[model samples]
Target: MTSHRKSLARVLAVGLAILSTGLLVAAQPGWAAPAIPAAQPVAVSAELTTADADAWLDGVLPALLEREEIPGAAVSIVRDGRVLTRRGFGLADTGISGNQPRPVDPERTIFRVGSVSKTVVATAVMQLVQRGQVDLDRPVTDYVNIELPTRFRTPITLRHLLTHTAGFEEVYANMILPAGTPVPALRETVTAAPPDQIYEPGTTPAYSNYSYALAAYVVESVTGREAAEYLQDEVLRAAGMATASFAQPLPERLNADLAQVYPSRHQQPIPFELVGPWPPGSLSASAADMAAFLLAQLNTGGSALLNQQTLALMHSPALGEDRLGGLAAGHRMALGLFEEDRNGRRILGHSGDLIHSHAALQLYPDDATGIFIAVNGSGARADSATVLRRAVLDGFADRYFPAAGPGPSPVGTAADHAQAVAGIYGLSRTPQSTFMRAYSMLASVQISADDAGTLTIPLLTDAGGTPVRLAEVEPWVWQDSEGHHRVAVRVDEAGAVGAIGVSPALVLLPKPAWQVMAAPVVAGSLGVLLFALLAWPVRAIIGWRLKAPLDLPRRDMRLRRITLTAAAVIAVGVTLWAGAVMQMSGGFSAQPGLIRGAQAATALGALGLVPAVWRAMRASRQAHKSRAVLATLVALAFLGFGAVALAGGLLLPDITY
Candidate 1:
């Protein structure tokens, strides 16, 4: 696949791996009364019992697994602080050579529950808060001995860290390393290349693994114990998650029981993955063990893990309601979880992705129920994991907790409001000052509007992979037809759409027309340059075969050579950069030297613009207007390409992404 397509696939995988609706919003001016009648949601009847859950899961999961070509999955369901059922489906490890396939075991097979580790780490920090060893409002710098290169004046606190509002740029460097790669100290790993902080603390939510790593470092600083050690003692042990561990290169006893992960069902198992930000997303545990952790969070089992009052504080909305505006109607950030309300019930959950293994954990606190599902394979399609994850969550909710749904109908001004907000949005979780900024462009989301005030975002989809269609229900607030997901927007003082909130932990900021068109401009310019340069070889062969000596002035000949050489260099540089990005297993940390070399080559090519411009002017003075136009076209194409590179920070010395 082309580098552009590959980068986009990776973005979609991560975006969907987390929940689809994950952004932020602020209040703006209110609008008028209803235009369209609201549609009511459908309700179904099903009791929450072990037998019912098993029957429901059997009817739903097996069909999904077979259709999606997923190898295996493990699930745990809990109610009233007790495990209702633990089930394993499909194979843990497909046959290798002549060996027999191993069936997944809910009690024995361990799966890496990626970012769910963030919830556990947040719990540890809260425990420290209860003991007076840590304060949620204190600046993180007070505990970790590292100063952040922040863009805003507000100090980053543990609350900001837990809620993903610290504003650190999204980074993927060293996120996953080879199994035997030596792990670094939390301090060193986090401090090595700190992401630039682009938003004020507590003002915007930008999902960040780096922020969680910093929070974990604070835990280490206060306790003088490795984060894993502290979590093992205070969190895991207390929750009765005996099989869980944050250790990379899992202990021999547990490693044997680890289910092999796969890119797809028909593919061979991938090698063991070592997570870099261990505290944020590196916990391996069985389905039964995960159930115990969920029960503790529900305040049923593992009550010693956290006190009731403290736990309540942790789960309550951490962001101020007034600051949230229309966003209050949508998702909101709690200390360690996303307040993803569904079917009128207040739900909190987090999704995790380890590339091969995808997991979703949801808590229906009011109903005293929680469900955990983790699959060993991401199906063949790019969005297979996303489809499966949403299906299980939505299916389970609809079966047992269905509710009548219909919010306020579409406002009279919905059409105009949708038009104003429809545009390409840049994710706040992107590198703002690095060459990786170029890659971030591929992750932009486009929101479209219809005359009826409905909106469509291709990135956010339902369980069936159809883009979730939305209608403006109120001023600055849009929700799915069934009210499963709510999206909110913020308008600037100038009355332009400023930001969008789809998830509690994420925000999408507006991208102006120029920024949105930059990639295509650069790509089109490359095509022009390549087309013009081809004339050089074509003319040489044509003239040689015809035996016609077509002579040109010495100055014109020199200019032609110079322009063609520049085009050649630009093409080679871009090709090299694309190859490097496609081959990178990690992020920018891979192939740094080669990427820098390409940057240098492009820099040298940009210098050709001066002579090309001079040549165009000189040619225009002569009798041949056609030659002048040709020269001018080449010069303009080169200029366009160079301009995008400079504007994107592609030629900048910084390579950290």
Candidate 2:
């Protein structure tokens, strides 16, 4: 769930983690940096030039694409409202042996821009605000046709949606569907089943595609037009992005030019991804079209799509700026963008990912420079696209605009602060109301503090793929010891860490020690249950062969059989559940029967505690020490497994994912 493929792939990832905790704890070899020599820092240039940008991209991109095994990508750099360089690399479609491959064309080949589509939607909402067609602070219910359910009285606002502060728990169901799936109206998707508002509006920043779709629905309701049409006519056309679209299954004209995304260069292309929430991540656009959008955002040559005041509002920090205390200095969420400052440059952008494709669009507002890059394949490692994009963005900033000096020094109270913040943390974007919560528990990250007070988070790494060492530079604020990434902890009144801000788009909520240990406990129970169940058959066979089964009472014997049955059922149940997760090709809803069967088996196993405990007591009273010990062990294992099932929503009435 921590990575970009946080849907079905993420469930498989967490299963691997739970089933093999040692491997996950040891290291992540997949994220290792490619064996490329580090480039020396270059002197600052007098002015941005097309020739220099072209030369730099030529030297960097081809090597990155080959090393990562990414099939193809398109990148465009915009400076002072003009495209400095736009280029494509590798084959867009890796043709069979009989046919020649089609090379990527920045001008014609379209790519799924993923979550970068959020920025486009945000721009559309701002245009409405500028024209007095929508209200930023008013409740979204005022514009939409649905009643958004929330526990808190605070109304969710358009501002909250733009900044990802609407607090909607992550929704993976129906987000991606089979290619030929019928496209639903924006209103139908948002109103069908609105996710519960898990946090108070404007309080916490949880990246939510659902919230973005709701915002788009508001756009539709206000304009009285379909979201795709409204966006195309007003936002895309205004920015001169003629080839960009928010339509699903894209128009036939654009579909012919769409790049085929692959799991990797060695694998076949995946099915055409039908994005349900089209406004959030369904935008298909060419690199040249994106370059034009950047130029319009920069308002170069007076071709601005938004007025100056509205544009500034869109780029300014709308959440987690000062509310988080010192952590506020770490990462900030600007309206529709992430405030990803680097090399002393104020960078604002959004990254988008759709299983096989990845993209990023970062704007250097201070220098009037923006670069958009999109990759067509995930490469060998599922995260290769992510790794490659980070390399380009960070490398570009360092080469063109280096930091002035070293990072801040540790504060006097660094040791105390580090000790307080060290613990297991879970992602805030997790689903709390479904069976998927079990996976979330398995995906918790442990942040450890050494004797010297430096905190280590193995999940977060540097550009070189090394675990970043962090030291508190202020109360509750930590800076990377050797890099630019910063971390900040939010504490409650009791002085315990409540949440952690790792980046503008990521927040990690603290997990109780018991909750953190649940996965391990369940795994241990499964092992014990297997051992007890296997031995039960062996003991029975031995007794039958010897014809010596006259020692125990009928009730005791019956209790023993029932207890063993529970153990066997639990083992089968757990195996089935794990297998379902690893083999999931669709949303959890797609395999309801398998999931429900496993749930029923486990629930029946939970009822074994009555007989299991009674059998243990009976054996103890009879002075049968060995039998008592084994029976007690089995009972404890059942108790542990049952506790986990109830806590993880595995037995919930509704079988929602």
Candidate 3:
């Protein structure tokens, strides 16, 4: 047998071993797991099959339009390394009238696969790991020489970086370019600042662009090549994905059938130039090519990209207790690839999203089944992908692969109550607000009842439309499938809900609620102070001759006014910061490092003012002294703020809501 067939045989043998073990485990007394049906044979075919696949698509297409408001989409299904279906509907480019969206030709048409590029990058990184060129546990600073501001109490590892547990803030807010502004370099774009972080490294899982960008940087540092070039040569080319290419500024000649990407919500055609960080969310490929990539990974079990042992390490989830959607214990991110169990089957895959495109690739190692979908239009709902996946699974579920049995029903349904449970609930002793009105707390609950009349309370989306099911363990507390739990509501004497409590598992205890609220206020106040400080020189230049009540030089009068404004701003900032700390600390002493650092900085700046004032007084006695001193102070302040801003930009985590 050829290597491919031999590899297939070995996979089947492993599948059989796992299935037998699972059967034995299921037969144990008191183990009432759901029955998983046996796998039915599917006739292997070379040409694409549309009959059943099209039927599945038929149900999915309208649902996409109704739920996601997506005007059009394209989907493809692959079985045993073969493309079974490739179809498309609706307009690829919404701007052009009378232009019907063409069918997705698997041999042609490039669709942007967003974060899925992370998987490819992960694959490349794993390859380096396999070659002993990179260590997963090492500090990322070892790979890149840039000094990261040390707010993290614990050293950050590569695994922490990949799993998004490094406490990085979401930094993709300004990802897209507005109108005619030049697109900044990927590194520059990712490191822009303003909003800083809430916690230190490894404290929480906040999805970030910086992590992936850093991953890309690691690939470059290890391989001595740009991430795009390395991915194209190592992963794509090795997997026989010829049509795939990383997004770049130069537009390459495309095959006639390339799918046009449209802007989300607005439906404008999205140009490649607009995608800033290519490694994070900017790979273009056809559906067939995507499927081939998946097949190569599953069939070779990472051998196609790296050694067998490294592939095993990549498939092994490093997240021990940290939970990701649909992923169980022993299942987490390896490099960029996510390994998880769907129903009873072990699957390895990743999802991709750009502003105008959405794609998914799933590989079922045991059954040799692979599914890939790519959409060209913007505003494509995430539900569309889920619905399509369900349909595809349904096609194979009863006929080809049946469930063994129902697993244990998730615990308590009491917290779920009903749609009547759906609403904005208020928490007692309301905390101060950061970005919005204070004294009010809002929590949205979405309740969906299953066939058994058991209420399933899931977190509601921002739009308040759908209910995401939660995992039940206790009577009043509920956890999302991903393990983020919410506490049950208790009504008080007036028959009104008094406090909606959340369990400690969901809340970050690093800072108190009031302090959390005050941080932004402090930051904003500081910003205003800095702005006023900056305005001093401009005011001196513009209002040079203006006189005020004070018997001072006109420029000195301007300086005094600006100084008063800045001092007032700084006072507010300090007050808010101190108040927040007092409230949040709750008798718990502040970290000595953080407290001392802030105090020292403040004291230094304050002491420096003695010299500054004396210099200003002397300068004021001389002509243009006030203006020159004001200019000097403003320049110094700008430099300080710029340094803090840069450090803040680098330290902030990347998260997506």
| Model 3 / residue 354 / CA error / Å | 2.4
In angstroms, the error of model 3 at 346 is 3.2
lDDT of candidate 3 over 1-657, digit per residue (tens): 001001112222322221111011211233222222223323333223558667756765656544555545556666665666766665445545346646556567677776677777778777777788888778877887555545656666677767655555433233444435455554464345422344455434445556777777778766778667788899889888888877543245653456666544345565552455546666777776777777666554333666655655565545442222111222334445544344445556666655446676666665666677666653454344444444444344333443344433455454344322334332111112121112121111224545432335332221233554544334333334432223343343443432233321122112234433332433443454466566656666666667432345576566555454544433433343343344222112223344334333343333333334544665656767655566455434433432332222211222111
- 229 in model 2: Cα distance from truth in Å? 0.6
CA lDDT of each prediction against the hidden true structure: 0.77, 0.76, 0.48
Error of 1 at 18 (Å): 25
TM-score of each: 0.92, 0.91, 0.57
- Where is model 3 more than 4 Å wrong at Cα? 1-55, 58-71, 81-85, 88-101, 179-183, 186-203, 255-257, 263-273, 300-303, 321-331, 378-402, 409-465, 468-657
Task: Sort all candidates by TM-score, best to worst.
Answer: 1, 2, 3
Better of 2 and 3 by TM-score: 2
Model 1 residue 14 CA deviation (Å) reads 13
Per-residue accuracy of model 1 over 497-543 as CA lDDT, tens digit each: 76788778776788877887876677677777888888888888888
Model 1 pairs in collision: 21-502, 21-503, 22-502, 22-503, 23-501, 23-502, 23-503, 23-506, 24-501
Looking at model 3, report the run of 10 residues with the lowest lDDT sum.
Answer: 1-10
Mark the regions of model 2 whose C-alpha exceeds 4 Å error after superposition. Answer: 1-8, 16-47, 97-99, 320-326, 540-552, 583-589
Deviation (Å) of 412 in candidate 3 = 9.1
Worst 10 residues of 1 by lDDT: 18-27
* Candidate 3: C-alpha RMSD after superposition: 15.7
